[model samples]
Target: MLDFAIFAVTFVIILVGAVLYLYPSSRRASGIPGLNPTDEKDGNLQDIVNRGSLHEFLVSLHQEFGSVASFWFGRRPVVSLGSVEQLRQHINPNHTTDSFETMLKSLLGYQSGMGGGANETVIRKKVYESAINNTLKNNFPLVLKLVEELVGKWKSFPEAQHTPLCAHLLGLAMKTVTQLALGERFRDDTEVISFRKNHDAIWSEIGKGYLDGSLEKSCSRKGHYDEALSEMESVLLTVAKERKAQRKQTVFVDSLLQSSLTERQIMEDCMVFTLAGCVITANLCIWALHFLSTSEDVQEKLYQELEDVLGSDPVSLDKIPQLRYCQQVLNETVRTAKLTPVAARLQEVEGKVDQHVIPKETLVIYALGVVLQDSDTWSTPYRFDPDRFEEESARKSFCLLGFSGNQTCPELRFAYTVATVLLSTLVRQLKLHKLKGQVMEVRSELVSTPKDETWITISRRRKHGEQQQN
Candidate 1:
């Protein structure tokens, strides 16, 4: 089933590209107002391609059409909802993290549920969720220790030294995720570095390989990619075996070992958590720091909140809720960056968004980018203002889109905790400043990132007594 899902998606992508090349236009199938296919075979795919990404295309589509819109991917009609009202009508309570699961499985070449029964599948998912949740609760001290180590590294730098924000955060995320997810072996810098190298090799080929048939076309790329994947699986398998033999229940792999999952199932879940957790956590921290650097007032306000809430003390899990402003900053960063800009689901049964009837099995897109920056929903939506989320209604609206609240997926919730801990620690100590004339552009993809290597310089904040003496 997993393999078929992967193949079907890849086939559709190729088929869409082929059809778009052959045909020039497609008519709308739903009542939702949106673009007709620019080409008959391609549908609106060429338009999406021309815009560079789905997020950009949807932004323009929502602007032209309205909150509810429709488009085509080859011959299949896609319904996109760009407003809270539209999403409320379309959102289903039973929606699981199937998309995230599928993407991770495809990227890692992990075929899940091979010969496993439905009960086993359900148990495996429970284990996966339990591992993450338990890690956050049980291993938070380890999390704090790792983040403070990052802070210590930054402090060691000479005052006002330029730092590569993305690179450093990615490293921090890798350490934290691997240590908590895989095992304590990742505590070694050497191990983390090797894991990251293999991770990057596989990540670089994610959409380029089996999905597009490039892996089959390029022998060398395929060989290197397979080698990296094999190395990663080997590492995960070793960790699982160690945990099972030792009967350890300290880390994420231990949780999986406690379950009845096969070695393959355990390894795949670890891979999914590692991949998603690192990327999302790294990007979230990067954006938070970038935005804080650009706005002195917001940064200062955040620092003040930290001081007022946890003076001369470290941020702990118990005190997280008290640091409400920190949560606001993280939420606003997610909104402003438009991180994870697009999410999709296949309509299980016929659905209705407003008056539009979405056909069963049709593709439904949640145009989160369009909704995040919608002027009607947010005041000065483009502005980096954390105060905007101070409102309960705003937070509720944000949660409605699956960015936060109980609705947020486990990986994202983990990220929020990690970002909160990092921000609370870093802001209280270092004063972050953007490089002069640095212009950062958002590259919306699986996750949003700076279009280029973003550089920032930091200076140590003066102590309260030192300021008074000065």
Candidate 2:
């Protein structure tokens, strides 16, 4: 009996040793690269996604890890590219796999059933380019018309102690975009206004839910989002149906109807395009105006450029080229504010960059905000200097990644044109001032915008007598 017990004990010890030796922990003896599993604190991945400080965290990581760094977001490996050169190489137009729709579907639950196929993508790009070219040819009259409408509405308002300029600007932007896109205005339409309100609310909630990773929750907010999307689709479908019956094709929606897509497909595309254009362009205009309100020198310089080129005559499409400074100001605003801060793509197939193989299905984010503000690439990176774009060399370096990149969205050109028109019209007419010492605070959602209740006061520019005295 004693000999048997000794043998069993020895066998058990040997088995236990073998098991420990073969375990994964023992094999590697360390955590995986880009993933720190042993850290007691919340990992950097959680820090970036959940903490709501992605911008700050990315900047810090870039500072510590150079232009390229590997990080994980919820067990998913994320490779952040911050160099302009690397970004340019990666954003090849031929890589249709890295499309905006695909990325957005993953991020925001947007479904692109309209089938923007490879050929469709090419055609869409041409359409957008044509639209922009047309805007450059004919936007001034449209701009003046929109501005006149906005000024009339502003004048009619009670001049209350605090007029919500953000709301007012947003309304104006929506009207202007709608007019430009469809050649029809819906500013005062009750149904359109309600649609705008609900759409904005739902989209804002969706953005918050996406960042919070709570989109799956079947809560009241989710219901709101569902309802908003349904309502928007219904409205768009109704429009499509009516236009189809009339056989009168005019605007973007009409063009979409004429495309090789079904009515439902056309409806969905129209909804997405219109909603995106309205929201982002509106927020951009608001932010740009907010910035101009604080910087008197910048505002004055813009006014001078407009006045010098326009010379008391209403701005014309022919005069857009002469407003070069206006374009610089708008470009600077986009770079500094970054309406769409982070653009994402997915590796459809295995690819190698500098001998580092990215496996299939890797998520790649080109941090545009970081790249635009990189000190190495931009001089006085933080300062709002529009003059940087005045030189051809500098302009080439400053990539407006808003349009025609791998992650390009279809509405970018339209947004740019609308912004240019709005800025030109407003700066030429009004001297904007922030109320007292109130500073604008930025809030980032689908697009970056000012915090709630942000206000700016506008007064007409003085005559030459007052200007000379000042």
lDDT of 2 at 390: 78
The local lDDT score (0 to 100) that residue 114 gets in candidate 1 is 43
- Residue-by-residue lDDT tens digits, candidate 2, 1-470: 99999999999999888865543222211111233312222224455555465555666667776666666554456676677776766665325533444545565454433355556655654544344345434544666687777766654544334557678777776776665554453545775587687678667765556554455455887777778778877777776777677775456666665656666656655665667777777776777777787799999998888778887776666677678888788778877786666667776566555435666777777677788788878888888888888777567656435432324465554666666667776777667777887876666555667777678776666667776321
- lDDT value for model 2: 0.64
The stretch of ten residues in a row with the least summed lDDT in candidate 2 is 24-33
Q: Give the clash count for model 1.
A: 9
Best by lDDT: 1
Q: What is the overall TM-score of model 1 with all chains considered together? A: 0.85
State in Å the error of residue 361, model 2: 2.5
Task: Tell me the spans in candidate 1 whose CA falls farther than 4 Å from its real position.
Answer: 1-45, 74-76, 98-126, 205-227, 467-470
Q: TM-scores across all candidates?
A: 0.85, 0.81
- Tens digit per residue, CA lDDT, model 1, 290-337: 999999999899899999999989989889999888899999999999
lDDT (Cα) of model 1: 0.81
Clashes of 2: 0
